[model samples]
Target: MTVLSVDDIRSRVDADFDRILDVLSKKIALASISAHGITGEHMKRSAEFVAAELAKVGIDAQVVQSHNPDGTPGAWEVIGSHIVDPNAPTVLLYAHHDVQPVPDKAAWDTDPFVATTIGDRLYGRGSADDGGGIAIHCGALHALGDALSVNIKVFIEGEEEMGSASFIPFIESHRDDFDSDVIIVADSGNWSAQIPSLTTSLRGNTGVDVTVRSLTHPVHSGQYGGPILDSNTLAAMLISSLYDENGDLAVPGIAADEPVGGLQQDVDEAGVRADAGVVDGYELAGTGSLAARLWTKPSLTVIGFDAHPVDGSFNVISPETRFRLSLRTAPSQRPEEAQAALADFLRARAPFGAEVEVEPTDNGMGWAMDPNAEATRDALEAMREAFGVEPINQGQGGSIPFIPELQRIFPSAQVLVTGPEDPKANAHSPNESISLYGLKHNIITEALLLAKLGK
Candidate 1:
């Protein structure tokens, strides 16, 4: 089988780019928000759309179902396979189709479901997150056409944004279906728009819900404020205890891993401030370089809290307060151990004899892959050839729970992570967008890597 020249592949992709964006627009319109009980018609439609797209590329695809943790229906997982040759190496392409909810529609410049192009940026929810990933895969396959050389398996996950509630069970029931020689996860981001990057490590994660109870019912603040402790105030203190004056994680068990030596992205202070909407004169928290704080060390986040409405003026001390805590562990740390330590800390720090309970929510272990693996080296070369720049070696601070499972199941398979997310992509945030330049280059790199591995 002869490989298509890079120019030919690029021509194919450029010609079909509009169709690729059309498919992505249709998917974005589905509103497949897994966490918001969107496992019904919308989810089904999204999966079917992907299946049809894969079919266009001569891949046999279907929608596979799994149950949510609460026994409710879960999003449909789209699985597609193309066997070019029995002897050639098989590659599994992984990305999610589900998207995060649009919390505030007013924040978006255009309708969240409508893909709007402003110059080279395409803006919409899921436009950059995984929708871009879905588009890249479809575009690459379409561009390769008859020249694609490897046995291919495309897994467009349905519940990744919901922390993959159905991941383990879905994998358990279809273990044999996912077998492959190489796995390419297109769920991460590039180091910058021009420079491609490969994620070498991912942080582990765990979450806990803590509730503080000070009284059975609310008490009048004017009458009881002097002696009575407010549950909300106590909860604040408990949260504050998790971080010291310097903003480092004060948790006992969570630990950082030794940094991977390579070409790491230097933090752009202005970029960080703008992205975070940080106020003037605010100092960056924690110790060490920004990369170390983000990718190598544990970070704590207060996700949500149960509190009174600020609009409703209440002169009462609250009876109960609840907040969710998420801890991102180092790549080498165990999420369960860190969760246990957090529980212990919360339990011991109950203020003013208030009743405190910490319930663990979820735990996902971290993953690290060999950057020097033969498949990885081939991928790097392909990327360099396609983009005309050396790929950046980076580590992701986010957690992809099922990656470690894939490693364990396919012990010999190489895993390569790549995607089109740049700093300005704003995935999972308002005004999400994808760089057109990055998207094209990523598709080319993936196509080239597939050709390289196929031979």
Candidate 2:
């Protein structure tokens, strides 16, 4: 088999992307939102869809599932493989088929499930997060055709949006199938639409639920509002204490710092504001380089609150209130420690001595990858050659607990996290999209890497 140049691979991928776009669009149309207590039918269909696509590239594929720790069945996952030579290195291409729920339908300018191409972006849910990733794997395999050298396997997860609780079980059940020499996790984002990035770090996370009680039972606000504060008001006070005057997370024992030597870089402030959709006259929270604040900071957010509903409410001093806090820890900190510190912080700072009870709801470890590995250099070189620009070593602010577990399970395999998501990708939010040029570059780079590995 003849090895192809990066330019040759780029030209082939650029020419072949029209078909790949159709593939991604169709996948995006299926609202495969994996969550707790939902029917797994959509997940099953999504897994089947991925399997069928893998089969089109000469990969023998199947839809598989496993049991969670509590014995509940897990969401469907698509696993497939195409073996050209048993002696060559095996590369596992990873992506997820699940997407976050569309919280508000009216907020969207276009249908979230319909892949509408506006300008150069393919607008739809899951288009950038993992659908583009799926396309990259499929498109690269399609572009390479019969010139394959390394064996390829695809792991399309179905429960990533819901925290992949069953990933360990699935891998334990199918250890041999998952064992590979290299793993490319394509669920991360690039530095920008025009710049490629290798995700080198991810912040760990945990959730804590704090319940504050002001009274034993409800009371009329008009009659009892003078001296006593409502539980909801008390909850607000507790939440406010999590941040400092500079808007940095004020939690103790968790501190934000700069990304290590090779990954240090600053992001455009205006671009970040626009991507985050900050309303007029709002400034970003936190201090220091934008990348450091985002990639390595500890962030505290009041994700869910149990208070009086605004719709049909009567004037009343609520007796009790509950809120869930999502704590994103620093990249190098242990989540268990973060969880402990958060619980302690809440317990100690009960505003006005409101009876507060804190419980640790969930936790997942963070991860940092080595920048000096041979496979890392190879992937970076492949990106530079394909995109004709220096690639950035970046870090993601999101958490993929399954990633650390994957490394623990396959300690010898080099994990390379790269993807098509950019700041403007708007992943997990309305108006989500992927840049066409970025998508094309990734497909070409992966094809080049596979070709190099195949040799």
Model 1 spans with C-alpha error above 4 angstroms: 29-36, 69-72, 211-234, 258-263, 306-321, 349-356
Worst 10 residues of 1 by lDDT: 258-267
> Which pairs of residues clash in candidate 1, taking residues 3 or more apart in a chain or in different chains?
none
Residues 360-416 of candidate 1 have per-residue lDDT tens digits of 998889888786789988988988988899888788888888898788778888998
Clash number by candidate, in order: 0, 2
**Per-residue CA lDDT of candidate 2, range 1-455, in tens?**
86777767777887888889999999998888886332378888888999998899878999988678788887798888988888999999999988888989898989999999999899999999889999999999988888878898888988888777888988998987899999999889787787788898888898898899989999999999978899998998988898889998887877565674354467778877876678999888878888888777888888999976799999999989998989888877888888998888889999888899998887888887878877788888888887888887788787888888888899999888998798788888889999998999889888888877665
**Residue 336 local lDDT, model 1:** 92
Alpha carbon deviation, residue 148, candidate 1 (Å): 2.4
Query: Model 2: residues >4 Å from true position, as ranges?
Result: 35-42, 101-114, 214-230, 255-257, 260-263, 309-319
Q: Candidates' TM-scores? A: 0.88, 0.89
- As a TM-score, model 1 comes out at 0.88
Q: Each prediction's Cα lDDT score? A: 0.86, 0.85
